[model samples]
Target chain A: MSAPGGVLVIAQAEGGALSELSREMLALARRLADETGGMVEAVLLGENLGDSAGDLIAFGADRIHIGDGAAYTAYLAEAWMPKLIEVAADAPPAVILIGHDTMGADLAPRLAIRLGTTVATACVEAEFVAGRLHATRSCYGGAARETLSFKTGPCVLTIKSKSQAALDRNNGRKGEIVPLAADAVQTRVRIVERNVSAAAGVRLETAAVVVAGGRGLNGPEGFKVARELADLLGGALGASRVACDLEWCPASIQIGLSGRTVAPELYLALGISGASQHMAGCGGAKTIVAINNDPTAQIFKSSRFGIVGDCQEILPPLIDALRVLRDAKDS
Target chain B: MHIAVCVKQIQDPEMPTALLRVDADTNKMMLTSSVSPVISPFDEQAVEAALRIRDALGEARITVLTLGAEPARQVLKAALSLGADEGVLLSDPAFQDPDSYTTALALSAAIGKLGDVDLVLTGRQAADFDAGVVGCGIAELLDIPAITFARDISVDGGTIRVQRVIENGHEIVEVASPALVTISHEIGAPRKASLRETMRAARKPIAVWSVEDLALEAAQTGALGARRVLEALYIPSRDIECEFQQGASAREMAQNLARRLYQANIL
Candidate 1:
């Protein structure tokens, strides 16, 4: 029952390889493809994506569209957009999904404009309602959820990270790779240099656990305890928007409306008051554990477990005890 | 060179989540009167980016532009108070509730009507819809090159250098005039409009143009031009009943919680 046009998940390569979100997009695309009785297709736009098609196929893509070029090594919207549009126009899938991260934010709208279509950004979920494909996206800074249905086919979408669990890779899975040439174009915007300040440790989006600190931590010094706990748990350390704005931590690790959205298995919020904007980002956590001195903090309402205590005092013993538990496991 | 900055006024994004109401019948989130509207924070950043160019250029004209009803003029004046020279408001009943595509259509039309716009600026995304599309949409419509998510920007002669904020580090992009740049929160903290400037802004006339003035048909723009429609909007309910841990001391509490977490295999 395969349809003429399948689902296309635009895969982005960061530092010359496919990003983690691409896997998640494939996961969601596979789900939607199953629901629509269509094939799941993926397109990789990069410089040298070696054997990426095999991995993409193993993950869920039935076919791969590879757009390779030196210009695509680093993302230049003008350089890569035309190629993507060409691919989309050729396959003209029923739906096209892109990650809502930096690349997608820059590329999706332009593609929509070029294709004479519209796009939905920061979508957390997707579904079919009344026999039409609908994307559920966060609105009003995550205070409200809105479902939108595209008026035209091959709807362009930018998928938010951490919205779906990535599928397990199966190298045995079968898929076909079709290479496409994306011509480079001269444009007003020229990227002279790219200096990436890589985030400290584990990737927040893929981490099973996250330890985030907020302004209530008082100062940057307080993040030390949060960091220790994060390290002990083998997870990523995060900060709320205010803490990031206050320069207590890097902006990249901020967990809030404008920052990265994470839905880790266990989200431990330390000294964070849980503003709606911050909650909007981490609302997907399987278990939210809040540790703050203020018992009345809003985070307590959403947390599955709450501890009314100072993070500075509680975290040290907690970390030590967790270390002891690890020691026991090793013994 | 004259630069136009697109700004929007949205129901306060910082409003507590519980107070935000959703009307099931209309499938819309109602903007309650309790929380007054404010300029989307990033749009304020966009105004700041324009003001910076104006500062460096000695006496460049900065025009603040917006597409909405009358109340939008207030936010436009807020930009004017930040050292903009003029304000252009695109007001029409047809402009209400348009998605970013239609919104961009109207704004680009207004920008085109303004004529000789050397540069354009917009917030990375509107705080309400949280769709960061209008800036690029306008660039596409106007056929101008766009640099998005700029953390820092500086203009030299006809070329502008923007330290674009990407996921990892940053990229130093150089784009020529007749371009557009989208401002993110990373674009330095926006300065508040001073009282003297705010009072002076009250006297400055803000020009209001409708769809007719922009040579745009009402039916072909705004809601009609919107490429997508909101079918339903609601709050996802949280059903978790938190388990509050209590103990004689912090150490005991930590110990008990660790034991329970370990027992549950979360550890």
Candidate 2:
């Protein structure tokens, strides 16, 4: 099979095209296309995604393949994988990139299976060399890095969350929006209900500010301070897996190798000791601040700034100060 | 009830770092030959869930299947010692490095060869790659219902009740039998194999099958059958500066740290 002359950016529209990660992927795809002399095709799979194509075009997509349907909305793997396969087959792209979310992790491997190619997940970077695609990814609990390459076509790679900077829009560029037929994929595993986390306030991936709790929170009640800070900042609340496993917070709020990865503008680590597994998930954040009573905590090693104090006493005053600062700015 | 749990032999991720080799070319870590291979952590949970279902149903049979090199027998023995009634090892050079889709198809073939099975269980994701797709892929191939990331499983009547762990929370789902489930660590810790049971497992017979015996298509069972291609792999550099504070007076040091905390706007 001949390699396609374009790159396909698979967009998981959980947060719509305005999502920072989608914009980042679009920017990365644009760079890859410019280097390889290929067009950047953004494939948006979601219900009611026709309205989002213009937004994608502004971000540098040369073509858009919209797989819009009810089934595409909630990310049913059996339904979405086949659609991706069909899109790749119809207009085979040299490479296919996806966001490293739950849907991407599930779909990439299945798509690789159907296409007989290599698929790398949670990739932090990629490039083309000698007609081969090379990607850098963290494996083995983030202990090491490995550069993998494909010997075949339609290489599938999922970019880790918050690793790339969002691309600035082109303002007036427009792309061709091609509606692709949704392949018939019969799945017995139906998603009957999707209950979003109401307590977490905002989705971790898209949040601009994130307030994370850790073992120092002591217990569930200790998380209230972190939650208050998140609410005050209009950010998302996150926790270490230990906190989640201990039932101090919902698993969705956990930020680690087994939990969600966030790349917020400001990440507040409260009582987090910063284990490697936990650090791997948050390395993409622009700036990190650590507050822990233990001055020797490992989190200070990763934070741009560090504070040695009890989060309990420190968080309340910090929240008050933020409130005053914001009120002053608004006034 | 007849349940089949697919397991894999994996390097112990928690092993001490001094015993592993880093692949110079790919920068991937290679387990030292001296390190022992164990059943994947998640797969052990799957086996435990299968045993629970068997105990609940009064009369049930459990079969464990693994597809890998011949050395995978060690893992099969471990599974048998953990109460699996029978074991099947699908060994062939073609089975090596087959991506998730091919592995699923090959495992499904092995299951079909086992005759009638009511439930199939596997780990949510392998520890090595952490790609949680096999159970769902097998479900797609068999056209059966599948619940991924299941923390709890039960059999009631002709249906299976499972608690699925999602991002923020969990859902209690009830599906009909002949379903597939991928168990997670949250399900329950796997029971240890007693010395007596381990010795007994050594005497137990393990059935071996080849790719030809399962009748899997050559095109459907290798890297050529993979749909996704890896573009590249590279290790990320860590910028960590370990800072240590040494002092004798606890109160004095605490006050000094407090001043530093205030300066950093943490207090």
Candidate 3:
């Protein structure tokens, strides 16, 4: 086998387009590749993701490898692992980056196991120093950050979403796209059903402004205020793990280290006490605004701006004010 | 039907943030050493998910499994109190420092040793490691169809229907028996055990298995089998003091905050 040198990203696709996390991982890969003096490549697996290769290259991929198959349509750890391992063997990259999403979470550890490495997931930052790669990931439920390094080359990482900026697309630049087929795929799982949720407004993962509510909102009924505020601002609604645990919101909207990571321009946390676990997910936001009744809540430390008050009393007026602002901007 | 539910005992996540300490030099997390360990909240939910399935199916045997030190017996006992039929604990000094992969390898071996499992259930991820890997890893190792992020599951004869939470929406999937499923928080909390059941749980024998008993190769089961190395662990230092808006009333604070957000260009 050839000595690994370049960085390869597993560009996972959702809804025909590459997932936002895949693009973000590409950005990180580009930075790492540039720092380490290696090429940034991507491996995409799907039946009809052939056109998405352009997007990958535009983001910084020097080469794109597509392993297209009908069996590869849905995310099954059993199907993608064999193909990804073969891809790495065929062109051994020094670093293999996979997004820490649902599919990535399932696929990365198993792939790392197959390749004789342990995977570091939910990594917020990574750097290559003197040819050694270091990753900083949150552990202990986001209360602490753990920096990891491989004893050998070919470190596999499951990157957190929204960790880096995607490079501006340049149609002028192009890279190599290689089509490879898995010699064999032993798949046991089948996606008997597939559904794409119709989000009322902006998607939570990519929203520029996020309005998240926590247990202090009291119950599922509390989300009505949050949803109204989100709609008025054209933002997205998110929930704390507590709210999700309490069945106040969908687990899909959980905003924490264990859930989705968002780097929105502005994050308005309503009634959240700002647990380290929750802050780990929203730490990347340009400006975090936290609202809680407790004056000494831990979340206030992570927030750039905080309002100490009852969300029940404050939210309605806040929504009214936002409506006035939106109405003014529209006019 | 026979089901295997994997659970773990973890440092209490609900401890006040001030009580948690990080040691970067040793890469260690100190949780005051006073917070009693409890069943990983998610895995506890998984135990409940299995019991719920048993409740629906009727006459199903549930085996609670854990791969950790002797203290992990508590997680098994917790599962038993919730009505699981039996318990299994995999413990050995060599099993120390097993990454998610090695952990999955050892757990899969135990499950295989148990034999005739109609379904395997575990939390979406352990709260301690929070890697969310072992369940799917076990499925891959066993070559069984695995469903994750399951909100709910219902069984009919030998078929299983699961409602899975996807990225944005929910999808209901149907599968044949002998499949693996990782229960998410959406499964609802496990049933609370009565004092009577808790007493009976104390007497429930937990079968302990060692790495040698499971016959797992050293190259495949513990620190020797791990792939990644931890270099450092630390609490990230804060940067900027949080500016709190002062107002006599909640409505006044809302108004001040709204104007301030506009001035800060965060609106």
Per-residue lDDT of B96-196 in model 1, one digit per residue for the tens? 87888898999999999989988899999988888999999999999999999999988888998999888767899998988999998988888888998
Docking class of 2: acceptable
Estimate, for each residue in B197-258, the C-alpha lDDT of model 3 and write its tens digit: 88788887789999888888777668787766777777767656898988888777887788
Tens digits of lDDT, candidate 2, B1-267: 999999988888666433556666643456677778888888989999999988888878889999888899888899999888889998877776676667888898888888799999999877666666677677767767677778889998888888777756776666778988889777756889988878788777789988799997666676666544543343445556533322354333434443443465543
Per the 3 Å backbone cut-off, how many clashing residue pairs does candidate 2 have? 31
The TM-score of predicted model 2 comes to 0.83
Q: Quote the chain B TM-score of every prediction.
A: 0.96, 0.90, 0.94
Q: What's the candidate order when arranged by decreasing lDDT?
A: 1, 3, 2
For candidate 2, write residues A1-331 as lDDT tens digits: 2233788998756445445667888888887777778899888877766457888888878898887776676666666766677778887788888887766765675676567565777888888777667787776666556666776667778888777766777778978999877555666565555665565368787888888999888888889888887888888899897788788987777787777888878788888987766877787777787878887676777776666767776666566666765676579
As for model 2, its CA RMSD to the true structure in angstroms is 4.4
Clashes of each: 0, 31, 4
Please, what are the lDDT tens digits per residue for candidate 3 over residues A121-231? 778788865557888887777777777878655788888888777777777777998987844475555567788667667888789999999988998878998898888
Task: Please tell me how candidate 3 rates in CAPRI terms.
Answer: medium
Look at candidate 1 and tell me the lDDT of residue B175: 86
